[model samples]
Target: MEALLLRVVPGLSEEWQGATPDEIERIEQLAGRPLPPFYRWFLSRMGKSMGKLTYPGLDFSASRVLTCYAEKRITPEPRFLFIAYNSDETMPLHVFYDLEAPARADALVTWGDTWGNVLHEGFETLREMLAWGAVLSFRVGKMPQQCEGIITGEPVGFLSRFDSVMSRLGFTQPVPTGPYCRLYERPDAAMVCSSPSAATFKGGQAFTLGGVDEGALRRILGEIATEPSLEVEVDEWMPELG
Candidate 1:
């Protein structure tokens, strides 16, 4: 998986890091069964760190605390390992591995729009998802290298609210880049929302802002900070994701 990601998307290796043996064992113990070979290989190679490919998008925990916050926050069955999720607020798409299936290198990947809505089954391998995620991250990182900022707030409704404000500003319709993210673009600026990970939920979700002039950025920040129910901090800097 590491070689594939590097080959497919260069410059990402800097953000990648391998997991230790102890970390792998801890995850397997949590699943109550050994993970698929491909998945274990992923953890061994790129589990601890994946740059933009993961961090608020396709977020797989380095801590490997396998828990799923579905319609209600309940413990998932041991056979179902909830590995990653988009925003818990908007269109909560989730990815998991079905341990009950015959063990294979690729594993049976499942996509759930909500808790029970299985939109796709056995549709993609863990490897494929990771590779695609890397591409998306690369594109996001390439956002206009002008003045950048981030809106940080509660994960529950932050992205939804941010999209609304951007839409009203005529930023154009949001394009779903991945299960966890949507990109909104305009002639002079662009914005993307990244779901909050377990590690950063308290600080809130990072809504990346770029490609706008100082005046435009100020206006955008005012709209977001004064919006109906959102309390967010507008930091005039891009988010740093490992």
Candidate 2:
């Protein structure tokens, strides 16, 4: 995990200041449960770093961790510990610690803040979780390089994998209702087309062009891609595709 953090966010190790053993003990006392071994090791290594990675809104400091746990200490079911949160503090990410496991190091299950539904599970250790996050971070452009070519250079397959990783990491956008033409306005002045059938919205770069026929959709997309002054009304009902 530390190695991955260094690779993804360079100079993270130097910036990190781990918590003292006494601080860790105090945190445990407050939480009324022993910290997982992998998590404790993580805290002992880099718990004080203010660096933000993966989730842009979160810091991995011990204080932040303790605060999140305290905030959710009253919630019931699927007992877990909060690890990180989104920018608005609406979503919290957590890890389920198995009390019965040997040293509580058997496996780690992660989840988002959607009523305790599991986001990911069966990670052998916290290191595995970090490793997965590293790959996912790369996919989402949070990390340095483009992960598209790392695995397979094919755009379609790479995009599929990218969406899969985002889903696993609980990065999802609200699906527009009825019919919509989703557009991806690219940096190179190219427009990408996406719809319910296409499902090509990548990394949240899409806007709803609600209820348009194929021709109108193409015209509006082209106008938006090139000229900023053009405006068009979208129909509420989607035309049937032959």
Candidate 3:
């Protein structure tokens, strides 16, 4: 986890290589309200920066530029969040654009002057941005048609492995009724007996992994026929400049 923090912290592109306690308080003053607990915690852990971490197969990064220490600005994209992280976790500050109505509203809604230089035109307040980056993760969203045995396998690959034993006994995608029918990805398949959460909406088939009972297990497996994988492209935010 610390290693991961090191990777992403650098990508946040914060300006403050070294921050002072007074600087942090000044930001709070500029932002008007107090910082969120989670954000404060993140700051203590990592300073701020445009982060970069290369996993076994994935190379990801994030970066942000500081505009001013005050006022939000509207930009073309909302997810752009008008924020960036430095490559070093020293300072994470809001990205700048000519103040636009939409950008200002989004910056304020998601983080107000924090995204603006309203606090300090430095990365001192990056702790909040880094924290948000940590929690706001996502996966592909093609959705599952059926979740029979809730087996562990890639939905993007060959289907012959799907419930091979059940053969003739099969079912189609279950019609969603209540929240339980909704979708969420598995927490971790590398482990045994893990389950997905129902509260997570329309993400993947992991939510029902162990949700069914022994009897229900058989019933679910019966629904496992198979479907061809149609590759769906995803929009990944490749943070280049911080």
Candidate 4:
């Protein structure tokens, strides 16, 4: 995990300040059980800070998670240990460990929102979730080197439709529906598409393309933006820079 973390976000070590033993103990007591080994290791090593690699919405920090539960802002569930919560409130996405399951080094984790919607179940471990977030942080945090674009037309199914089109373009959906966004990746580049939830009607679909050269980014954008299934105008941000 350490190797993968460093690989995804360079200079992360300098920013990582782990939690103290007392802090970890307090959290464990709150949980009424020991945290999964991998998560405990994470708290002991990087709970204080994860720099840019810390997932945007999920609250993996020991102190924050404890506060959320201790203060009763979000009531804890029976037989379900909450590892991360939607601190950003961009979406209700939260992750938890099933305490009733058999004990192991890592617990079975579920992805869901505060509204009791299980976005995904048991598809990722604590380590894998962190790793995926690292990759996304590394990609999305690339900044002005990337392109931001908006799709015109109806917003419903925009992100899912974008995912479908990108998948056909050789991109794979590594993880689906985290913080109201979906991530698609390929060898040379990665794209993140996000839309307001079906309940919200404020914003349209937007995406960011990074880890690719300007030329390739433009070409790929042209391909997807022109696809008949996604009938929308892509206002590429790459042009103003040139």
Candidate 5:
């Protein structure tokens, strides 16, 4: 999985650093639990890079995860250890590790933004979660709410330019949204556009773009390619339902 991500995502593995024995012991002491072997290996091999994804990665760092756990304990029962958060922290994913059975691999779980309902569960291990590719799928599925806009006036040659740009970036082909518009999606994000003047993009909650011209559209994609968390504010709007 690590090798695949490095090859396909580019720059994702540049900051990876193994955790020290002292760091590992500190986290186990902090959580009052023994870490699962695979998970412990991951921390020791790739903890730093986990949170540096184009989309938000798990808060795998010992200090940050411990801090979040502390914060959550004020109101709710901290039964689960938060492992990752969506780009804006609207959705946090967790794991129910058996503190008593420290070596056991457990399921990954999550709740909606309200934390009142379970959004997902049953991922049996960290490897299973990554292998399933649920992270990207979840991000894409939630994108419509994060950023959306309509292009009022069609701009000339927009579709072709959009296709050329996205295809060059190795994104899947655009899916038709309407006669004049199409939606292009990748594992990490999605975009909808019609002609030269308007488009909407959702990389994550903090990363969005909307109502831009062709020049701006190109620039925004370029910036996103470089830094997926790049944010530009535009008037908030939701996609019109059928």
Candidate 6:
């Protein structure tokens, strides 16, 4: 995917729509880490989610972590990741809630508006930090009061590095916040999922949180599924992708 993203140029011709060997190497240099397995597989199925979900306009699954509207190519905004904490589960935390997970008492250190996670709070506190931390700090908005993140990848050692941080904050099992995003200046939210994850979008597209109108949502999703394909440029940026 990084390789594919490298060849992408703003408003370039269609010839630059595919990834080249040189472009891939450049992206690897930029990302530092090689793309993940899922992303690798996702690259094979490029443009699958083309026109599916346009809110975050997520190019691939990983793109939903930030707050940027999706277009035909990567949004100009640099990527950012904010892991939210959930405190209503068992075992190592998995999900990333989009709300503010740290509080006044839970702050590790502050330089004014900088509220850091209390990973130094200790294991139990870490559990609490991930739990009561309002996990939605990753994305700000009025989302479901009780949305849970799906935690896959059994034996998720990815969270081990922060174990000490978790312990310092007095946390146990916490609720998991799944991948989500929000609009620029609204309380609306949009979720990312392979199987038709739908919700009200920034541009007036709306759907119930859950258990409200699945049939209606399904119909809306079906219509959305049929929308025009979202065109993507391999190593180019298009100011007028629309």
Best-first order by lDDT: 4, 1, 5, 2, 3, 6
The residue pairs found clashing in candidate 4 are: none
CA RMSD of each candidate after superposition: 12.5, 13.7, 15.1, 7.1, 13.5, 20.5
Candidate 5 residue-wise lDDT, 59-103, digit = tens: 556555555556763123334444544344544544444233221
| Deviation (Å) of 161 in candidate 5 | 42
Off by over 4 Å in 4: 1-4, 13-25, 28-45, 52-60, 64-137, 140-145, 152-161, 176-179, 198-204, 236-239
lDDT: the better of candidates 3 and 5: 5
Candidate whose lDDT is highest: 4
Mark the regions of model 1 whose C-alpha exceeds 4 Å error after superposition. Answer: 64-74, 102-104, 113-119, 134-242
The regions of model 6 sitting more than 4 angstroms off are: 1-25, 47-49, 56-208, 212-242
Query: How displaced is residue 170 in candidate 2, in Å?
Result: 32
* TM-score for candidate 4: 0.55
lDDT (10s digit) by residue, model 3, range 93-161? 333222221221222222223433333221112332232333222111111121222343443332333
Candidate 4 residues 129-214, lDDT tens each?
Answer: 56556655676555345677765444555555666778877987654343245567777788765555334633355677775577
Task: Estimate TM-scores for all models.
Answer: 0.47, 0.44, 0.28, 0.55, 0.40, 0.21
* Alpha-carbon local distance difference test for all models: 0.58, 0.43, 0.29, 0.66, 0.44, 0.25
Superior candidate under TM-score, 3 versus 5: 5
The predicted structure with the larger TM-score, 3 or 6, is 3
How would you encode candidate 6's per-residue C-alpha lDDT over 56-161 as one tens digit per residue? 3113223321212223122221121122222233322222211122322221211110132222212111222222222223222133221222212212332332
How close to the true structure is residue 40 of candidate 4, measured as C-alpha lDDT? 83
Candidate 2: which stretches are off by over 4 Å?
1-9, 30-33, 50-54, 71-78, 89-106, 114-124, 135-242
Across 1-242, the per-residue lDDT of candidate 2 in tens digits comes to 45545755666666767877876876666546766777778778767763444346655567765665667642434355555444445555554543333223523444555345556543434554454444343323331212111112233343444344334433332221111121121221112112222233222222233212355445434443342222223332223344
Candidate 1 lDDT over residue span 142-205, tens digit each: 5544334455555566666767877888876432332234456566665555443233444344
